[model samples]
Target: MGIARQLVHRLEQWFELMGAEYAYMATDRSNEASLRLFTGRCGYSKFRTPSLLVHPVHSHRLRAPRRATVVRLGARDAERLYRSRLAHVEFFPADIGAVLGNALSRGTFLATVGGYEWGGVDRFLACPPASWAVASAWDCGGVFRLQVRGASRLRRAAAAATRALDRAAKWLRVPSVPDFFRPFAGWFVYGLAGSGGRDAAMAAEAVFASIVNMARGRAAAVAVEVAAMDPLRGRIPHWRRLSCTEDLWCMKRLGAGGGGHADGWDWARSAPGQSIFVDPREV
Candidate 1:
């Protein structure tokens, strides 16, 4: 076997030995070699196409919808809410509580408008707003930094000049390029979901914007990955220039099984779920 296939087999064997019933992976849709390695040689199948929505953090703070009330949720409360609300989502991790409570997690938050009142966590959980959204923040800054590669000298010089100008004149409000040449920190918004429809989408956008605001000064960008058909995706505020819609996730059952429903349901054969929980640890 080739080196890549051998590496994949080794990882699969290790997972299976640890009692894993399934294997999952994601790759850029443009990577033909990776697609073949995972799907053709490794027996994985095409599963979900989630878009990586990204928004650059402006020098100024971003405002959430004026009418929306954003609230940070405790880890326990966030975990409970996600369990109940996202149980139907494909590839939902079982250790979501650990993820939410991780040190790198900034916090989980929710947004609601239309006369929604804060009545304690229990009450809020019992009767969530008819139009609401929920999301959790992961400080990817703690994990790693990203830097753009293969830029021409002229483009690099222009980016540096823009940054310099923005720093020199605070009031210019120049839409300068982000610090892509240098390593930059960023935040990831995972577990993104909305109740449904237009109102819920608005609430979701507000929550996402709130998270971006929270990351101001500390992160270069804010991002979230959501299934293509997710109801709130179209409304979530993200810069088209910084977003990508071609991230593909693939999955397969391990061992002698042929993608069987080991857990009473096979996510591989299931239709596109409403959303996906992007595990921060994997990112």
Candidate 2:
């Protein structure tokens, strides 16, 4: 086996020891070798497409509205906001627990209005403070979910929360929130966004604005890996500004691939399979 294949084997073994159900990796669609390595010998089945959005610390330009409030999120409130997010979207049963755990972790912020939680943004902040924060807003625009409860109005709430973050970013003058997470400085926003409701499109736009504003407040630049083909989506009339960094692929292993479901299938006896892979970064 080649070096890459050996490395993948080692990784698979390590993850298996950690009780991983299946292992997967993401690579740009333009990278034919990586595509082959994962699909050919790694035993990952293509599942769905996912996109990555990135914002640099210097490209932020949107301005926050005149008035807004910013507050740090407490653990309890953060958990509540996380639960609310879970209620709004559909997540894979296998990945829900891990996702929730990460969301409620320390690197999260909740945006509220009129003393009520309106939207929450969570990011993974660790070393490389420059890439410190990669956040996602719960409600952007008028749409949040199919069944939103309580007094929080989607669009208005989202706008208020977004504006607050923008203001914070401006006060920090870092050019990007994610960059703040890095110790040495210079990072950007990277993650995914999806909306489900009557005003999904509008919500998406608000998400974009909020993201840009947050970046600009830090004096940073933003790059989005958009799945939408609509001309109105993203920075509007400037789609090329964002470059494609990687193509996320959904890889699935059939019939008890791992995670306590592997008893029924015999990996040694089955024939290897292949499927047409598509870029997940589109949406």
- Encode model 2's per-residue lDDT on 1-283: one tens digit a residue: 9999899877777876787655556567777787788877776655334344444433335443222223444544444444443333223123333433443222233222222233433331111111111124321111211222353455546645554575567554433223222222212222232232223333344444455555343333344443424222343212233445356554534334343233755332333221111211212
Q: How well is each residue in 120-224 modelled by candidate 1, as lDDT tens digits?
A: 667877887889899999999998999889999999999778767766875785666777878999999998887847888888889999898888788889999
lDDT for each candidate structure: 0.85, 0.39
Candidate 2, RMSD to the unseen true structure: 15.1
RMSD in order of candidates: 2.3, 15.1
With candidate 2 superimposed using the best TM-score fit, by how many Å does residue 271's alpha carbon deviate from the native?
A: 22
Candidate with top TM-score is 1
TM-score of 1: 0.90
